[model samples]
Target: MNALLDLDQLRTFIAIAETGSFTKAAEQVNKTQSAVSMQMRRLEERVGQTIFVRDGRQSRVTDTGLRLLDYARRMLSLNAETIAAFSSDAMSGKVRLGLPDDYAPRLLPTVLASFATTHPNIEIEVVCEQSSCIHRRIQDGRLDLGIVTHGNRTQERNGRIIRSEPLLWVSSAHHSVHCQATIPLALGTKTCTWRAAATEALSKAGKKYRIAYVSSSAAAHTGAVMAGLAISVLPESALTSDMRVLGEREGFPEMKHCDIALLRSENARDRIHNALAAHIVNALDNVSGGAALAAE
Candidate 1:
């Protein structure tokens, strides 16, 4: 029996689904439109039915195309696996992992220590940056994996989402700002997920505010906040004796938590990648769970 499809045809189908046009898919895949059309034809012939339903400008996937997308992802993933399995070398190579800044306070050291114990030969490099930077590094293959924030992961290469937890407002114990005046605020740069969440919530609530302290580092933000000059937002686990959550400051916005993802490349089907993902997931779950217990 002839194989039902080739890798090239499956990839063309995914491009069509994503781009919604044979012409666009052809350009994206660097094939002629006729070639793309012929590939779809051959694919349909193998499956014994049509895979796409064309209506004017839009090309919607038929029931078959949708099912085939899942297969395509799995196929491509395994294809990647087959290449990596043979290509993988001694695990002595370093693993470059990216992380978000705020998450580092409680999560980073634990994860690194555990991974070190498991893969002592493999050196680890940690780069702490914003969530967007982490995602870009993961996509560009600069970071083998990352503990990124609020990233939307797809089935094939979207990476694994590990934790989602609420971040709360943190202020010095002596905060006296009322609901009427501008509240002194401490926040990281504009690209920060937690900072954006807090500012957007404040804008929606029409709360008067001013950035009393802006810092490049989370430690700096915490310092200004602890000095009783500004208030900052952080994960609840970041609490300290000098800092506490504001209870009566009124008009807390409904910012639904942040997602912290344990992401790796689609190419990370190697044993090293699998081991790292497992260890990181367990560490993050324990960290979040243990923090929740402490908060309670």
Candidate 2:
């Protein structure tokens, strides 16, 4: 039995399995769709196993493919670690990172400060966008890694859960916005999971509400909340002194918890990338400096 596996094909195979779409996998690997198909065929031939099956124009991974996923990830991780271990030159390269705008003010400084302390030579390029946009960039290989809101565990194909925090309903500290008959709300766009959760919670609680403002920017959400225009949903970290938490006692329903995840691209195979990922995970896991909203 030939034990040799082409790492490139394995990488593409991992991409396909993770993304659940050949078209998306192709985009992530920067390959033509045909090229992606050809690579998968070759990979199947090499393994002598059927890895995927067509399901109504969609590619579904076979049992063998699911089994291979673990091996593939281990192989790639070991390969990258081996290369970095023996490399003579110290780690120094540019790593692209993406995250939602809301996280930058609180998350960026802490993460960058710690990482930079040890890896000053490596350049970190940051891009702030919506969590969905950041996820896409990581998939498309435009980013080395990203911090994103992990909505559904089953739907999040390629990311590690880093932090979990309660999603709180908040309004201006000095305002009576939450007292309105029809509770005015500021929230993310329609596609945002947070927005969906917020609306769903309101409906289930039999509360009347109206979307008074919609924006992807955290600053915009904060602005709406601060000016007493509307109540908004925010992660525990993003809370500020000027915001007051709303809960069942205040006639607001309990919101779902928000999870923060670290998503890495297939291109993130170097020590620098790994280092940054580790730092981010560590920083977030131990984070403590937000408005102390936890009830005693």
Clashing pairs in 1: 154-158
Best-fitting candidate, scored by TM-score: 2
- Tens-digit lDDT string for candidate 2 (144-227): 999999987454656788989999999999999899899999998986879999999999999999999999998999999999
Please list the residue runs of candidate 2 whose C-alpha ends up more than 4 Å from where it truly belongs after superposition: 1-89, 153-155, 290-296
- Number of backbone collisions per candidate, in order? 1, 0
Q: Which candidate tops lDDT?
A: 2
Candidate 1's displacement at residue 276, Å, is 1.0
Residue range with the least summed lDDT across 10 consecutive positions in model 2: 287-296
lDDT of each: 0.69, 0.81
- What TM-score would candidate 2 get against the native? 0.68
